[model samples]
Target: MPDLRFQSQPPAHTEIPRPKRAEGQWSLGYTEPLNKNEQSKKDDDALNVRDRILYTYSKRGFASIDPADLRGRFRWMGLYTQRAPGFDGGKTAMLEEEELDDEYFMLRVRSDGRLLSHEAVRALGTIGVDFARDTADVTDRENIQYHWIRIEDVPEIWERLDAAGLSSLEACGDSPRPFLGSPVAGVAKDEIIDGTPALEEIFDRFIGDPAFSNFPRKFKTALTGHPSHDVSPETNDVSFVGTVHPEHGPGFDCWVGGGLSTNPRLAEKMGVWIPLDEVADVWSAVASVFRDYGYRRLRSRARLKFLVADWGIEKFREVVEKEYLGRELVSCDSPPSPTGHRDHIGVHEQKDGKFYVGVAPVAGRVSGSLLVELADTIEEYGVAGARLTPYQKIVLVGVDADRVEDLVTRLDEIGLSARPSQWRRNTMACTGIEFCKLAIVDTKERARDLVTELEKRFPDLDTPITVNVNGCPNACARTQIADIGLKGQLVMHEGEQVEGFQVHLGGATGLQANFGRKLRAHKVTSAGLDDYITAVVGNYLVDRQDAESFATWVARAEEELLRGEKALTPS
Candidate 1:
């Protein structure tokens, strides 16, 4: 009884497992998704891991956890089993990712750079203390990270987080990540417009939505109306930097495709001025373009940056406006050169005439107990709010003017100093080999030691230079954009293999935004890191122009000076 249409099964092509292309040509089949991870996402939505964790993994021990879910789906719930102990740096590439999995996990709680209530801060502190082995670090992306998490405790951790109005969902993985905004979002005095409403709307309506759950790679966003550029707009996938149209008062400028891993690229502007009400829509449209059109064949080229690079800004914007947004965006002028501080690392006045004290933790490392103490101080002082900055610093907003001095003194006693030295102020380090499987060298402790050495050797060397240390080439510490970016690896120093770094010089953001330039054949042994930096920085102090920034001086410095050839323990 069925009417059968004349459909013929096409004969199977006898091609091998190669892509449907001849050498370089990309055919329709070649453009199709081929990556195993892409297939995994299609087979099962990563969000389903929440239920699995609640009903299964939480009850079963680590041995009972499924291998696929352990390595892939667990990320959707903000869980990553840390690098197993006893694995040396040399084994980094030799073993599979699963082979490096540890019995413990690292859990990241998303804050999205929004102001957290004192109660919420205390709850997070408690979670860190009780569930995460007293480990907590405020990451550059504005997430609070905890280590030593066990699979059995995830359900309890989720319960504690839910009670505090926090969740780790979509915090990591190939999905929309926590939104990054100005730490001083609604409280800053000079902000032209607050961006929290936009972030809030996006988070509520879209972050966990299945439509965006299958991106080829993770999406990072930054939004802020503050002139300070405190959110690091230069290195995000989708950034809304505050700007104003000549005719239209104040709004934001949309920049797409900025990211900072192996293939470093600064975001390019779409030349459009977005009204406050339209920001969430514009952001969604941009995300849609990435979801539907991004490359999925190679994990290496999956970032939105690669798509934007291939299409160019004009075409990328055209596709969004035409296929996604059904309207035109108001044209805007070029972004103004940044004038305010990037780190926001000192006491500053709020619009309410209140003070917000920025406290620096040594390379963003802090204890769970110390965090609880911070919450106590905030409550004690009746501070208006608390936030984590993009530079891995903390700011207590709305500190009473009269109590500012006492607050600073108390913070110092707790080790979150209001006034940190130059070495501490400018250095940033990633979760190196101690915790991260991808890292090959030390970062946190090494950076701390480097700080001490630099302070002792060049306490009076006053040029502002940033030293970013990463365990490997992933650039998680934003190493590519630092004045002295160090990518860790093993190298032969003085004819013996040792842990060391590949140097990247002169990178910066804001007015002079650019990735650091590489020095060919330049690798410094870990033992020689301090000496190398001292030699290079010391040279800059003597040879630099009167007001030259460290990045500026490095741009003009000779190769010999940058390599610190004379100071290095030669290979």
Candidate 2:
């Protein structure tokens, strides 16, 4: 395949149109068609007739060829360019074709905004690309992903994605990516106001901005006006959390250094309280500071957390204050309120007379078909759009009171019904070794199996238990803050090597955030992992104090006690 250099294009400045019926609300649209000459040029640039044919078939599905013929065509495209169908044999070899690993491909999709689209999925199916829906898990950040996309599909996938309102702007290569917001940001009854508008504005500005598109390192930002810690602002590079200050008015309290990549660190407060009116400027200033001072020499040490650690919190704040305020920093007029709960699941009434439904996904995994179904469902039953929560759940906002029952029934039919007693509701996992090479175990599969078993053992368990599993120490599942956190590892049992996990307990996500401490290490085959987890939970339930969260219980448990509980024989 020829290395084509598509010229970098600047974002076109266009006025966002207001919906005819709403006052401060605007509707998002992507009606602009690509120029014919440009499309023709793109088609012509695709290698040969075979490449063009496969590209067309991928977009539409089903090629006019047998399996043998398809294999021959793929071989001709070369191993580097071919998209192999599964997790068996030479997977890395196939990944080598596009200069990216399968895990990076999934990350690219989430970062690029092209992961869950009808055309993108169809294209994968066309080329005999057996991408895994299970492998392409959702992040706690509310981004959907697909793993193992072929090199040939990249261009067409990107083009179709542009037409679908998904942009590849800063999805990868060290830049500020999607602006994270609460899945229920605008619709929650307790929300001071929806932060989506501001979030969308920030996204629009940073995604294509030359200054922000290629920063020194990856930058993450999240916003939420809701008091709940659902968005997990303490774990981002730059977080704008909603708070009410008498002098600053209703706005965000900014924090920096929180991230979960290589060197995990909680973000520290940088700005005391930034007023709503100054959010854009404050955010822009923080980005500028990161771009200018953030280390670029080493990938592992490139995050803003490293910068904060190197300079200390005070110095980091000094830099941001000097740059943002153009003078000395001032003390905060008011302290932030305590961090709230982590229950984004279950049914909840919105400030509007209608209700918002939060459905727990076994893992944060959604297919293109699911997305289409969700879109259709929202159009049919919802007054507004569907919002995604960081918990890998979907919130159907503004459903009519009369149709809530019908909506619930339809959701169940689609295999997305919310359950009050399911253990899977509180379980979260990151994409593991099946998709990401960085992962040491199959976190998603393990998490699902564990939840299923826990439900069977403790059928009526009502206490909200957060069990997070990460394939590696990267903590993409936010395991550090989970009540029961599991980081992937390989363990030896009776001189035989097997996949196992190290457990951490007592982690909490709040004002006094604390990373969980390592507990007992457990070794079990993938099939029996669940029974072991259930036993551990059973011990916690019996020993915990009234109203104590699982994390709190784990924190108070003695090491010997935890070890004994983990070593219990599975019933």
Candidate 3:
């Protein structure tokens, strides 16, 4: 295959139109974009910088990099200049990208399906040790992300990745991101069908293919053949959830237009059944619809969910079939609700008579040394492989049943606990003010501290509660879908401004997916966050129905209790 620079343009689509209705949110409101938004730069094909990075700019260092590529086009290659050290949280919105750009960068290596061979893991870890300042973290997208990466070392990092059969291509920006796949796809006993082959086909056909490279905004996909719904398909741009039709045996139920962020929406079932063999084509058709008709005038409203919301599921289905696929789909019922074990934590029996052990680190903050140690330990246990989950956990696969106990014990020693406390297992957070330029407040460290505090405070609490914290409005940690979600921002504290958070109560996904409710005009200083959560959760512990979920109680609780009025002074 020829490189994209030499290849011809992809097939043309109908021009993007400004929505005549209620779609003109901030992104689309402008006629001729004043600041020359990303759309204009993308028009020249963002993927046209292969030689520039490898041949010119990289050799000359970051100083020689093109301004356009440095800030915008670099995302196509999954690189972002991390926030410079010493930039406080209060300076978040005040500084522009250039002013905040650190000499080092953050690289997100796509983990399509989270499959990691021992050799791949070791190579990645070695790169972290050699060049990335020994910094590596597992992201909720199942990616191995690195911080403090110098621009000069990027080519060397790519070389190591290639040797390990990996690439960061199309991992970020306005392209299809790494798709979420069930970690136990083939191993799970109750899996409908293995979605592995389908995922491989989709990646080979579309990833880095300039034809599908450009879109209105980033597109996300998730597919799972397991009943557990471990892939969290309900919150993706497009998802193929495992289901067995009464007559068709096992296949997939397609859902479209799901996404989280400022405007959260659950994906609606497309009322179609897709077979494994044809899934790649169906996926392409759905993506094509987004390319041709998705709103591009506004970056904020450009996500596929917005288009699906405006068109309605029926109309969206009509366009997908008539305009893109050219074939009608087999109508089928929606898949059943996911099992309670979406996280896939702890040891579970696989169909192969072996077992897979799932474990989590504190808020996904594993270092490169930890990665190497994990890979070495899995090798010692004779485990065939490992896979990452959207919940920011890792599962070692194909371990003998007899080795389960020993392996779990070893994992515990390495700080990856197979049997973690509720707080340790349930909490997830995004890279916040520590590294990300767009973040308003700290998240990773804050979440880690919160988990420890809560575990100590509620050692005997039985019911499970999810806590998701996001740095900004982007909701990278899926804040809107957690039982207790904290969105970071600047809030007035004691007549002065400081880092704080706005709370979202009772958010949940799966059978009854809905964004959490908010206490209007309520924000809590970061310092008081622990007290606020402890008090509110304590209130729930004292008064509740039998086996009542946090979401259920939150739905019925009074505003006073949810706000922790007695314990907190609201800002």
Per-candidate TM equals 0.93, 0.76, 0.93
Give the C-alpha miss distance for residue 241 in model 2, angstroms: 0.7
Alpha-carbon lDDT, every model:
0.84, 0.59, 0.84
Clashes of each: 1, 6, 2
Better of 2 and 3 by TM-score: 3
Better of 2 and 3 by lDDT: 3
In angstroms, how far off is 437's CA in candidate 1? 0.8
The 10-residue segment with the lowest total lDDT in model 1: 1-10
Where in model 1 is the C-alpha error above 4 Å?
Answer: 1-33, 339-341, 566-571
As for TM-score, the candidate ahead, 1 or 2, is 1
Tell me the tens digit of each residue's lDDT in model 1 across 1-571: 1111112312223232443532211212333347678767767889988898999878888998888888898998999999999998999999999899998999999998767778888888988899888999988888899999998988988898888778899999999988888988777888978988998888887877877787778999999998878888889999998897878888999999999888899999887899888998888888876776676777888889988897799888876776567666888885685832477777989898899889889889997888899889889989987888888888888888999999999999989888888889888899999899998998999999999999999787665788999999888899988999999999997787799999999998888888898998889999999889989887777777778988888889888888875433323
Q: Give the per-residue lDDT of model 3 (tens digit) for 301-420.
A: 889999898878988787666656666788888878853447888999999899999998888888888888988987888898889889999988899989999999999998999998
- How good is model 3 by TM-score? 0.93
